[model samples]
Target: MRGAIAAMVLTFLAGSAAAQDLQARLNDYPTEARADYVFGCMAVNGQGRDVLRKCSCSIDVIASLLPYEKYVEAETVLSMQQVGGERMSIFRTAAPAKALVADLRRAQAEAEILCF
Candidate 1:
């Protein structure tokens, strides 16, 4: 029926729109942040052209998995955890901080499995 055909077309268009939105969000990830991740990944894996490809793939996967704002929050918590001071205790011990870092870690782990 024409109604059934129209409903299928509407569903397809909606799904296509959502996919484009997700791709736009992933593209919004910053270049500097992506470069920093690739650099650190190369340092751990090895410095080579192949490592470059793998690192780039890793960041792409991470961007797909995590929104840029949440990624930045997780990175900030991790960086603050490295400092030594009473003020820094919250970064190390707070539940919210731990959860943010955990989410980032999970994303990174998934990226590694998929890309590396």
Candidate 2:
């Protein structure tokens, strides 16, 4: 029926809009978040340990899937820094987060876990 078709169309449009919003939010995520995402990926991919190869793969995967903005969100939502076993980082990013991403990628590239 026409009513059914209209309802389906409305649902599809709403879903599309929501998907766009999620993408936008992901893009807007902060550098710290991105780091966190990296940590999470490292944790998951490397047998519950931080493995550089796994981390790199995870970052690459994320970079390929996200637009610049979503990548920023991933970076923001995921970024973190551990100093003397204390984790610290900014949790929100209102800017591009590219600098953070670049810095983080470089740090990750060079990092070796001193403990754990």
Predicted model with the maximum TM-score: 1
TM-score of decoy 1: 0.87
Steric collisions counted per model: 0, 23
Off by over 4 Å in 1: 1-5
For model 2 the TM-score comes to 0.31
**Model 1: how far is 22 from its true place, Å?**
1.8
Q: Best candidate per lDDT, number?
A: 1
**What TM-score, over all chains together, does every model reach?**
0.87, 0.31
In candidate 2, what are the lDDT values of residues 58-104, reduced to their tens digit?
55445434455545444554544322232333433334344556555
Segments of candidate 2 deviating more than 4 angstroms: 29-53, 56-116
In Å, residue 95's CA in model 2 sits off its true spot by: 25
Residue 39's C-alpha lDDT in candidate 2?
A: 78
- Residues 1-116, candidate 1: write the lDDT tens digits: 99999999999999999999988999878899999999999999999999999999999998988899999999999999999999999999999999999999999999989888
Worst 10 residues of 1 by lDDT: 22-31
Lowest-lDDT window of 10 residues in candidate 2?
80-89
